[model samples]
Target: MTLRLSQLIGGQARPALSEAWLDVHEPATGTRYALCPDADGEDVAAAFEAAQAAFPAWSTLPPSERARWLDRLADALETRIDDFAAAESRDAGKPLALARDVEIPRAVANLRFFAAAATQFASESHHGQAGLNYTLRQPLGVVGCISPWNLPLYLFTWKIAPALAAGNCVIGKPSEVTPVTAWMLGELAREIGFPSGVLNIVQGLGPKVGQAIVDHPGIKAISFTGSTAVGTRIATSCAGNLKKVSLELGGKNATIVFADAPRTQLFETLLRSAFQNSGQICLCGSRLLIERSAYAEVRDELVARAKKLHVGDPLDAGNQQGALVSKAHHEKVMGHIDLARAEGGKLLCGGNAVQPPGRCEGGWFIAPTIIEGLGPYTRTNSEEIFGPVLTLQAFDDEDEALALANATPYGLAASLWTSDLRRAHRLAGRIDAGIVWINTWLERDLRTPFGGMKQSGLGREGGQEALRFFTETKNVCLNLG
Candidate 1:
């Protein structure tokens, strides 16, 4: 299959406005699959211009009409589901089942959710007899969205759906590594007859194209999903212009299994949480903090389960854990594995890469790694590895578990597995992360607000709350005397 990257601007594919280009690789074989144009400042400016021009008309449309466009876009996406999944798997090393079953479906659902949410933007009531006052939700004009490589389609939809639902034009900058699916989405938007300039996509490196988008005066807000470091940079740039910014950054999330928790159930939940998408999730439960009494049993089960995970080609139907995004990411994950050893963390099981039976040797595959005995301050415990690696730690009591869970700078998400209802409620309240799951990990409802509390990120990204984030409230007060 041949994949070609194109800039989607003004409702059409256009020629590259930049001189540079990069190869999008197929991680399973370490081969270049397509040449993605590296957009420069001029290209980003053009996208901004498109969005800025479209904003007035698009935003003026009634909320119900805006929703119809999103509904149409969702239908369009559904028609191309298989193609989207295949490209997602090839471009980002996601397992085919995951792309088909989880990512694409979730993306479609997000669009549908936002379509319904768009019509709920009624004016806020003010209990004041002094004057008639109500707040109107208004779009922020143009939103410049930068999505990460991991779960590119899902993250892109997370931003686009709400931005459009709130009646804003969007200029999206997907990660250069995983631009194929995002570009295809832009094409689908056009096919659905979304007005020209309502949505635009420019593929390029962050330093050049991303910076341009952030710096563009025409862009009223910046929504980003990526590493905390890059998020900080984007925040700084937005601050210079006082542009509205919402970021979902890195995480070192924890999964605390209490003594009363069902051991088998917790083990299975952790298995899915820590290794899904090879643990490339920002909200993945990377730290497993089991109650001291149940630590031995949980660790034993986890190690056995980790060994059973299938590591192989993403295209393979049976593979559970696939390769990291690229050679660079694979090496980075290996470096963290080496760091774990240096920090005196015992390698419990599966620290090295494995070429699956009958799979090519060149695939960027890494085994499900488990390490134990690392101190809370150790790099293995403190940093976000963004790979299929889980670190184990034991906590004696509830307070210690909560402290360990909140120790990291990140506060993206956390999970508590316990049959004790009181303890579950108490810890769920105390955990500093944004989303706390009781007896589950990484399970989310589209209608609930989702985001981190601390350095993890700055704002929420789901449901009516997310719609508010994309819009500014204006108060219109009039007096009739």
Candidate 2:
């Protein structure tokens, strides 16, 4: 099917007036399968204008009514789970299984979770000796949500659901590279009778539409997810107006495997963590810090497992891995591998970009890569490569492991593999990351605050943190005469 995607403005689908279009390709086949609006600042200004106009009605609607709309949106998305998964896999170059089971379901859950959260939204109250103090949480007017290409609809809804639930009109823009599922969302919202301008989408490159969003005076808060460099740009841009901004940015997360850890379980889980979605996720562990005692044993097993992974068509059930999101990204990942080799890292397995036979000849496929012998501060080890590339380093003890894990400027996430419960808690607490997983990776709770420390990101999202970010707090005190 030849797909032509459009922008959503005032709950309607319209082609961008920018007169430019981006070809949307299926990375699995390296085929141009669709076209998406290459929107510009004009589209962004229109979206903001619509959202700004809709803010009063949408934000003042009874929370219960808003909750119902959200519930309907969830139901609509749930019913089309297969459709979304298929589209998302093609757009993002992720495995069909991952999309069907993890990404799409989480997108559904985001809507339902926020729908429920809206009904029971709370405020703190304090009873003092002479007066009563009450805190009020009210929606910020028009807010902007910009999501990355990695997870598309999953993270797109993660930001949008809460903004709408908090009674804020939203101007949302999905990554131009993976706008398929988000376009579907725009369709569903209009069909489900969401109020006009409640949720608007503007499709474009970051420098254009994204910059417009940052500069817009009417948008009160902006939630963004992407690279640390881009996040820094957003912070600087939003600083002039002092707009509320929340960023979920880059990471060079670590997986610490202790000697006492279950060898089999660690290897199996580590494979998924290192190569899942081709390691495009911000939370994926690109650095492995193995205890010296079990370093050799674990390294050999992990390399063997990486060799067995099937890399081919995304729609193929037998293929365990899919294509990279784009040819540019594929080259970037390959460049990182070359840089790793130059830095004196040993390429243990799978560093070449492959041209799989038949339909995927031109597809962007990189074998699951493993590197060793690089120092903690090496460019390949410290930078956010954001690919299926992992660097291995051995640590002598817990303190050494901690040092290696936190050495990078990023403090996004970390995974610890240890049978020792005390060490898990001790090390987890001491780790600089905002999210730490013990014996597991990518295990998420929607209610917990999710974001990184240091350069990884600023602020948090998920559950009440999302609602809180989209709204303003006002304290009202009653004095007794």
Candidate 3:
């Protein structure tokens, strides 16, 4: 039986008011495992109503009380880790081990981190010469959070946890492609008897439910993570209403390798940064910038590693890479690889789709691809492929490397491998990216602000920045005469 996922409204899971459904595919096997509600305007309106009704009471509660609720959510989610892990793997087509080990745990951490943040959420107070002035950070009553399909629950909770922790009533829309884990989160919320209407999960196509959420006048803020195109639309929509918006969008990040870097450690992390999750991560270092002296060596090692990656069912523990999230995405990635060739870039390895044995024979599996002889400004090097594809560019010196790294319009993240401390510090300042890693990639500290610069994205998320984004600030002053 194919399970039918439902929208969570007023603390209940129910089918869409429109009575329509969308097929939810298990990408690893190219099969439909579930049916998700194709939420329409009615469903979104209901969610907005529920959240708006709950907002006043929920937001007025003591921050510590709100913290307790999120803690309970974290505790409940932890007990069902195995179930969530399996669902996340099936829904997102990521490796089961990755879901179990990193994704789900990080999700749990997001909840707990924000839970603590609620109790300790601080406000600014300044003592003037005569009196005192204080600032109030108050939650935006009803907020909308739309998460992308890439990391599923990890990012779903990432936006939801902080919004709720800071006392907002949320109407969240998980990507229809990976709705199962978010559905499971709703089930957990219901089981825990979470406050009715405080959190609503609407699952459906972006045009229907996502647009409704953005268009709804009741929602005070919007937090979205997806492609640049959709984010641009959301920003435009929010601007007319002057609604607060936080967007984390696309990236064409660069991984820079210097000659003096540790060879063994460089390749290990290099491969992970380039191809982990089939290169679906927005922060994945899809563009490689290498020093001339080490370019050939690093290029060869990366090619060898890319060819050896095992692509198969997500359930298999031995496989290194799983299928793409959908057939359409698979085609898009393949098309980019073809574009590379057409643009005079030579494919060093892996420019074809893979048909793994057994049940995954029909799955959307693309082999890791490395394209060289591509200049800094080529479409293949500058555009976001968002698949298992990497472009190689050799730089003559530090100045050249920095130029290549910052060549793209995106400035989300960059990874630099170098032993020269001064060079690391110097180049990091000039990289133009929001986050720069020296000798590392994908390492994150939740307390630090995270967001992109330039066309990559607008506004920030994580730590106090997230809390601040979800709130309105008011300053109070008292005079003593």
Candidate 4:
């Protein structure tokens, strides 16, 4: 029997008011394991109403009180880490170990981080001779958080935890592709006696539930992470309403390697940056720009290492790579590989789809793909394939490497491998990406602002930025005698 999931609204888990349901697939086996609500505008309206009703009281609570609740939520999430990990792996087709060690733990960390940040979230005060000017940061009444399917609960909590920690009531929309863990969070919220209507989870397709959240006037702000295309549409809708929106969108990041950098670390992190989570991470370095002096050596080693990555069921401990999130996404990645070939790119390693033995045979799995002979201007090099696909480009000098790194429409992140401190510092400044990692990739510091430049995304999130984004700022002036 397939389990039926519920929409969480008003601190209750119930079926959507509408009878329609969406089939929830377990990507590992291409099987339907559950069903979630195909929520419509009515469902969204209900959630919005609940959030709006809860906003005043919730926002009025002391920051310390909010922090306490968030801390409790974090504690609860940690207690059920195993369940969340298992659900995340089944829901998003990520390895169980990856979910346990990274994704779910990160979600718990998000709650704890924001919990601590809430008490520290402060307003600004300015001193002047005649008067005092102070800036107040207050929560937006009811906010929307729409998270993508790639990281499921990890990104879901990343958005909502801050909103809640900032004392705003949130109506969150998790991607229909992987909604289980999010639904599970709702169950936790209810069990912990989290105030009714403080956080609501609406499950369904983007056009239905997500669009409703965007269109609703009651939702004062939106924090969204997804494809650039979807983010664009959400921006358009929010523009007319003047609703505050924070978009963390797509990325075609670059990984640059210099000859003098540590070879072992470069090779190891390079493979991970290119192919981890099957390269679904928006921060993944899809473009590899190598200094000519080390191009051939890095390229050959990368190809050999990528070929060895095991592709199988997500639950299997031995497998390093798991199924793509869905059948449609799998086809999209495969299509991009085919496009690369047509564009005159040579496959250096695994480019074809893989049907691993056993249960994952019918799963959506793509082998780690590395392509060479692709110019920086080619679609395969510049576009965000968002799969286990990497394109190689050789640069002779710092100027060329910087140009190649900044060539794409996206400016989300860039990873540079270099022993020269001056070179790293100089390139870090010139690189258009929002994030520049020297000799490292995916090393996150929660305090740093995270976002993208140009078409990658807009605004900033993380730490104070996230807390501020979910709030409204007002400046007040006082006369001093």
Q: How would you order the candidates by lDDT, starting with the best?
A: 2, 4, 3, 1
Q: Of the pair 1 and 4, which is ahead by lDDT? A: 4
- The local distance difference test score of each candidate is 0.88, 0.93, 0.92, 0.93
Model 4 pairs in collision: none
Question: Which stretches of model 3 miss by more than 4 angstroms?
Answer: none
Q: How much does candidate 2 score in TM-score?
A: 0.98
Give stretches of model 1 more than 4 Å off. 357-359
Model 4, position 67: C-alpha lDDT score: 90
Give the alpha carbon lDDT tens digit for every residue of 5-102 in model 1. Answer: 78899898875685567889987777888888888889888888888889889999998999999899999999889999999998988899999999
Judged by lDDT relative to the true structure, which candidate is superior, 1 or 2?
A: 2
lDDT of model number 4: 0.93
| TM-score list, all predictions | 0.97, 0.98, 0.99, 0.99
Instruction: Report the number of clashing residue pairs per model.
Output: 0, 0, 0, 0
Model 1 weakest 10-residue run by lDDT: 354-363
Model 3: per-residue lDDT, tens digit, 1-481? 9998888999998899988899998888899989999888899899888988998899999988998999899999999899999999888888999999999999999999999988888998888564888999999899999999999999999999999999999999999999999999999999999999999999899999999999999899999999999999999999998999999999999998999986657887888888889999999999998899988889998899888888888899998899999999999999999999999999999999999899888889998889999888889988899999999998899999998999999999998888998999999999989999998888899999999997789999999999999999999988855
The RMSD (Cα, Å) of candidate 3 is 0.9
lDDT-best of 2 and 3: 2
